[model samples]
Target: SAENVYKADGTIAKSGKLKTGFTAVIDSRTYVIAVCGDVTGEGNVNSKDVTLLQKYLCDNAELDGAYLKAADFNLDGEADNRDLVLISRQKN
Candidate 1:
């Protein structure tokens, strides 16, 4: 089966380069694909992504696929306070 790509907010993803945090729904599954550090899916790395990662750490939000991978700023095979600190330092 095939379906249109979707954003995390459930909207059809705009036609353009797929960046970090930009979500996709395919085959009845949802995934965040491409890049790293753009957890908010706005096509750029910034403070907003940092905030979202913070919320995720506190159990206030959810991140999967590439979103989770991006949060792994240190490539330590997990997203944690260390990754959070690194992400915080990189945000624009």
Candidate 2:
């Protein structure tokens, strides 16, 4: 079902490239896919996600992609180490 989405108003979400998620045939002819809850970005969010999150926590160390994302688990369009502590309290 990774096809295009067509609205009754003649709007189309078109895309020349095909991907795993939904292809929106409306919003600028692109995909309207949602990568939800993928906090780890390892393709899926699961138990091992915490490890990825921890790697990002800087210990007077260098910066990396995982650190960037981990510092801000919610991805509220910002990166702050404060978010990391919040995520650490998760059961998973």
Candidate 3:
């Protein structure tokens, strides 16, 4: 199953860990993937993600599937202030 996953560049994802803002092809189906804390979906976890998460918390912006998942930095099934705080502390 792991071999069926791939990175956005169409290369085999050796570690099977796809980063944010990239796509993953699994069993031939393409899926937009996300990295924990990289809610802004720009491929890295940083201040931008923090700002976006703040807006999302206040309903000022929207985070679709992948982005939303990324926002849930702790994988707690939901994005909230807690996750935002944790993401803020994460280094790229």
Candidate 4:
């Protein structure tokens, strides 16, 4: 279901199942962007993202380049509990 629900560029269109009878219009002038704190690359912020940040903080995992940017929710040049807090507040 997730595979059938993505945009033309292949990112997940929404957090969960697509509602029946719903229609989406793509704006050619604009691009769908990944939300900040989407460290798991799921295109939405959730507990999984927070877990990734936690893993990175504990040195159990590492993030670099684009992943690093996503993990840095505060844009303060580091990944920490503050970023985790921000991400925790985000709902699908």
Q: Which candidate is the best by lDDT?
A: 3
Candidate 1, residue 15: lDDT: 80
**What are the models' TM-scores?**
0.66, 0.35, 0.73, 0.60
> In terms of lDDT, which candidate is stronger, 2 or 3?
3
Of the two candidates 1 and 3, the one with more favorable TM-score, higher being better, is 3
Model 2: per-residue Cα lDDT at residue 79 = 48
- Residue 57 shift from truth in candidate 2, angstroms: 3.0
| CA RMSD of all predictions | 4.2, 9.3, 3.6, 7.5
- For 3-87, candidate 2 gives per-residue lDDT tens digits of 4563323455364332223335554565433333334433444554445445545453333443354445566855445555555
lDDT of 3 by residue, 1-92 (tens): 43355555566656734576566556777676788897865667889999999999999999888889999988989999999999999956
**Candidate order (lDDT):** 3, 1, 4, 2
TM-score winner: 3
How many residue pairs in model 3 have overlapping backbones? Answer: 0
lDDT of 2: 0.44
Better of 1 and 4 by TM-score: 1
Instruction: Give lDDT for model 3.
Output: 0.79
Once model 4 is optimally superposed onto the true structure by TM-score, how far is the C-alpha of residue 32 displaced, in angstroms? 13
Per-residue alpha-carbon lDDT of model 1 for 1-92, expressed as tens digits?
33666665667765876677556667888665756677776777789988999999999999888778888878878889988888788878
Model 4, poorest ten-residue lDDT window? Answer: 17-26
> Which candidate would rank higher by lDDT, 1 or 3?
3
